[model samples]
Target: MQTIVYDETNKINEQAVQWMEDLLNFAADKLNVAEHAEVSVSFVDNAKIKEINREYRDKDAVTDVISFAIEDDEEDLFKEFEGSGITIPRDLGDIFISYDKAVEQAEEYGHDINREIGFLLVHGFLHLNGYDHMTVEEEKIMFSLQEEILRDYGLKR
Candidate 1:
């Protein structure tokens, strides 16, 4: 699993970026992602994320994270290429996280910044993998899985 991280805000340090990489690797292992899978994670400020949210979701409010899953649209197309001796890397998707919201949530939730960021990363990763919390049942399942993954990753609240 290759996780390309872009710190658009330039506020995240090297250590935080490295930790995110390690966390994504661990998540991929736990989720059984393909070895050739690739995902991009971008950290941006509130203004940028709010713009993205408004453009993509039509909501003017700032969101903590947003995921764009490639498989959601091109799953069948990729399946056709399977077993044809083509080694196409599974480009899962991109995840954009709001750095400002992360800091605020960390303080609000009474946890470290790493924990909040890790939670957001895992949440976005799950969304890329087809997890949704649109309904009550779905919320229970998705939230439980997220908590389990976070706990196992040692990012407990």
Candidate 2:
């Protein structure tokens, strides 16, 4: 999978960036996504994430991660391309992660920063793959899948 990661806040070091890439690749494999599947991940600070949450979700609060799924529409476009017998990669979506919140949460959750980052990435990746936690059952299912992927990736928490 093509995981384009950007550190917007300059807080993520090279090691963290490498971890994110590795986690993303593992997540793609767990989700059964093809190597051509494309996803963009951005690391931002709490202020940036809060602004995005307020603008898009009207939450006005800092969140660990946010995902925008563009695959459905892209799938339709891909079908049209298929008519022409031209294959195209899938643009899954964008994932925004708040490094500040991740640090805080990692401390709160009693896990390492890598585990926290992996959890956040997996959670966001599932959303890009059409998972949701709007209800208790949905939350359970989504959380279970997230944990499963993380555990398999050796990021148990």
User: Each model's TM-score?
Assistant: 0.94, 0.92
Task: Give the candidate number with the greatest TM-score.
Answer: 1
Clashing pairs in 1: none
- Estimate every model's Cα lDDT from 0 to 1: 0.93, 0.88
Local accuracy of candidate 1 as per-residue lDDT tens digits, 1-157: 8889999988888888888989888988988989999999999999999999999999999999999998876537577777899988899899999999999999999999999999999999999988999999999999998999899989999
Scored by lDDT, the top model is: 1
Model 2 residue 127 CA deviation (Å) reads 0.3
Superposed by TM-score, candidate 1 places the C-alpha of residue 52 at a distance from the truth, in angstroms, of 0.4
Model 2, 59-116: lDDT tens digits are 9899999999986654465555666866677889999999999999999999998899
Off by over 4 Å in 1: 73-75
Q: Model 2, which residues run further than 4 Å from truth?
A: 73-75
